[model samples]
Target: MRFIKFFFIVLGFSFLQSCSNPSLYQSKHYVFGTIVDISIYGEDEKKAEKVTKAVLEEFTRLHNSLHAWEKSDLTDLNESISKNKPYKNASSELIEIIKNARELERASNHLFNPAIGELINYWGFHQNEFNSMHPNQLKIKNLVARGPSLDQLHISGSTIKSTNPHVKIDLGGYAKGYALDQASKIIHEHHIKNALINIGGNIMAIGQHGNKPWRVGIQDPRGAQAIAKVDLLDGWAIGTSGDYQRYFINDGKRYCHLIHPFTGYPVQGVYSATVLIEPSQNAGTLSDVLSKPLFISKKEDRKDIAKKLRIYHYLIIEDKHISMTKAMADKIQFLNPNTQKNNQIEITL
Candidate 1:
């Protein structure tokens, strides 16, 4: 569906005192239905803008092609799915993304599902502005019973077909990471020394800002201030999935867009989950997709999921309680000392 998500992580950068820091150039754009910022360090302003413009253009192309409920290639695929029609000439890019998302979806124990777009739409997440209404329980029941999954869609070469009429492809859960990876490639091609790309809250760091690493802050779920700070090394990407953004409250309950494939309802109890991905073949994609299963899984099942996914660094805030892996605890500096002292911060294996 057409979804709008906010930054789950509060980002902060340290800049030099000089009013004209020629070594660093920054620009912000509105894309992916949110604010995207690009910063390049140790590069000329004109070169930075040129490179940034290319990245922005790429983002726009992906946005137009992958939009869930809009008039997009993705929507066209969904239409074909509903009618059991096969797309013979689909773009290679779309096919590759679907295959990648399906792989990640399977890796997530199906918790990171993008196939249930209709379920998301039923919850009023397809609109730019939510009317704050509870989804229909009967509709949810029917959809959940249908149990549309990514496996139902078959892909080979340029031809793609769906076996299930209920499956509606939505890449909202995975597009930011894909975009980040693409942006990184573009910047790397330009031989940019160091750069940062932020799509909504998903962030990727390349090289360093001058001689120091690029530092970022994870926001407090209840307030504006950062609760923790982290330093990003080269080729690292980080993101957070939280109920704080794209949610509605009704009858004293919060309904977020991170819907469960099994229950067909918004997940509760956890305020947010943050994930860090080390430099790898798909670090950006991992950073974006990995936090989702953590937020969606129960506390008891979290460790098993993390182990399965090989996720070593993570932070979870459930209600007022906090927990993280030992690696995360070592890497993050908690900005709120009271939070660190008052709660029994459970360190997961």
Candidate 2:
């Protein structure tokens, strides 16, 4: 006999049902300021629960280690660079994250820098309080002066040193994707053939649903409704970054959470960016890190960069216009554009 249940809870809800003989499908959410929704497709409920717990635990561990606002975390490492002291042998996990971040910085021509933590704080995006005050010109100049390039980081095995004492590292751009990658590995090792992991805005899909691709909806930046839907077959990952997720309004102007490291101001022109990639141990970390830079780049320059990196399947929504890369346009199939009354333009990637 197959058993399934669906229940709605105020804080978190679960939807579970059995389709194939023994295989079950379940979706649930975990809340921590933001909610992480996870969907599992498998036969063993006990095993699925265990895998889910492991994935969540890994997320918690990474959050505690990398969150800059947490005073108890190793944030002191960001300030001790002037002493010529290397960060005390960091965990192998953190070391790998740092290495990947540095590589991304180089790949994006310093557009995707991890050494912008101090700048992030100065802009007040890290604070939960929504304030629309922009930093002054002098403050912006000082912060930019203190910024460190990826080359300034020296790493040997698990040890890391910073050439600039003012350089502080923030993993907000890539940590969730890295965590999802690690969690997916854990699930696969447990022999779970199908699963979906969503950490905040980062999403990963493995296997299929009843021989059909898992369906993911890309939310509209202007509202809560989904504007586009993409199918994930044989496992893929998708990530979306937008100004709509977090913002504050002041004097009739809205300030978004994503700040431009160069100007110490919020990034403009583009409203949202969504990236799709094959999910592996790294999932879509590279894509997530590159999205912001791609969003702010000129149309021609963005196309050139995407082609150089061999990223053809991505979407950018800017100035209320939608554009898709030729590579991405050929693969993505849109389901519902008129689902809601909101205005959304869809383009083939």
Candidate 3:
């Protein structure tokens, strides 16, 4: 569930010579076993650090409370599936997240089930490290058969109970986006106008740098020297999931970290998928969870999923072609196709 972290280096002192006094704010390994980098333009360095630290602390608190992999967090909820147990009440924050997860599960027809902790671990994506071993078909089938449905979860007020004994929830896919949204709220509350928050490959841009939008580069899956750049106009969160990021090559076949819930195996046919979503829209989690399924799904199903979820913009890179959502094609600027000899084409969704 962890996306590869790409560090953007701003090189040379010459680039800094123009700013009157640019304040750089950065916090690494903050939460969810990922590095978070925050850069605020034209803000006091001391004040920026204080705000960043506070936000990071809040994110960490949330992670400790909700992370299923952590045994301590599992104590807070009722684990009994056969009999409903009214355990300790859940925090408001946890309630909100569970609500959002439920909504996403319904919207995606359980394609984005958060209760797939066992499946994720079976595939070894939960370790936050690159997995070189590919699970056998029999193992995948067994894991999928034991996976729980989202409907088994019961939320009564602040309390939650599971109807399945083996149903373990993993918030890795949506937690980062949720943290970004929360951090953005904190920054806004502090009256910060312009900033950039990058948690792994998930990035959120707030306000603007003069008239220019935040420029983000999508890494090439084929291990090219340069990246495909995308320009963002106001505040939006962009996340990219790629099979090329954390994968294993075995017997000339590549196995990716992103596992299909139904098949319980790595999805193929697409190298990468990038999703752009407005902050006002709750599409970040949806995009993260749906990227793999959309890539492996048939063309008609892909279109149907996009329409059903109302995705704003997306780019799908397959072995031989590139497909773009209608919304993405309208705003995206493809730069320098000549830089690479490979064929590049755009399809309207």
Candidate 4:
């Protein structure tokens, strides 16, 4: 309903569902600040519908509790932090999520920091509806100078306190993937196979669609169609971070939500980033969280960061052209043989 994030189109699933088979069921909901799509294949309608409902319930719970600016546990924590008080009201679930987000933030050298949410709000992103407004340059600089790093937060059991008063937590980067993991858990517990859970553009696939791997189209950031398609295998996930999600044009500059902690400004140069993560305990989380750093990093440093993060399959869309790991190029089938034909294609090992 708000911003158009990095969304994907499921290619052949519609045809499979339209065959009048009770084995296919799908549903969509507006949650987690974006659209959520759930599809289950080869399950009876009753079972699929039940499981899908459970998943949506799980998403709604997460959305209500984790929302950064709303009256949520996160907001409560931020409020306490602002007043220099230790917050103990957070749920154990939220604590764990915060712990994981902190570790991920540290892993990215704080490039994926959620602690700069004060700066995020200063840019007017906390609103339910966004308008084209430029933030005050002096305020942006001050927030950047304050440097509220997630590492500054001390979490002892249920209590979370921040050393920097400016440290406000926004788990927007990680919540969807956490919800995906929870949905996967629900699907597994219910013994439902062959399901796809997509929150915004972060997607996870179960078993398969009948006998074939589920194919998902990575949406082109600048256009209406998918630039390429990939077979989303079981236990794997894919996600993209694009400037198109949230931002306004000012003086011909696109100021997006993916801000730089050190600069206190939206990142430029890159348009979008896509990452494909293998099955793991936190595959969904990694898929959701890792794309931001890639989108924020300098073009030449892509390989280094990918190596440090151990991300094998990656793709980046820049203003001029696109770049990707050869592993990613190998997995993706470009919709047009000459995608972005006007620009250069850079592939790395």
How does each model score on lDDT?
Answer: 0.87, 0.67, 0.67, 0.86
Worst ten-residue run, lDDT, model 4?
13-22
Question: What local lDDT score does residue 119 receive in model 3, on the 0 to 100 scale?
Answer: 79
- What is the number of backbone collisions in each predicted candidate, taken in the order shown? 0, 5, 0, 0
Q: Write the per-residue lDDT of candidate 2 for residues 49-137, one digit (tens) a residue.
A: 88888877877777777776676244766756657688777778777777778877776667677788777877666655646674587
Runs off by more than 4 Å, candidate 3: 1-30, 72-87, 129-131, 224-226, 281-293, 339-341
Q: Select the stronger candidate by TM-score from 2 and 3.
A: 3
lDDT minimum window of 10 residues, candidate 2: 3-12
Strongest candidate by lDDT? 1
Candidate 2 shows a clash count of: 5
Q: Each candidate's TM vs. the true structure?
A: 0.96, 0.85, 0.86, 0.96
Cα lDDT over the full model 3: 0.67
Q: Which ten residues in a row have the lowest lDDT in candidate 3?
A: 7-16
- Can you tell me which runs of candidate 2 are displaced by over 4 Å? 1-33, 72-74, 82-84, 335-349
Each candidate: RMSD: 2.1, 6.3, 3.5, 1.7
How far out, in Å, is residue 287 in model 4? Answer: 0.6
- Check candidate 4 and list the clashing pairs: none
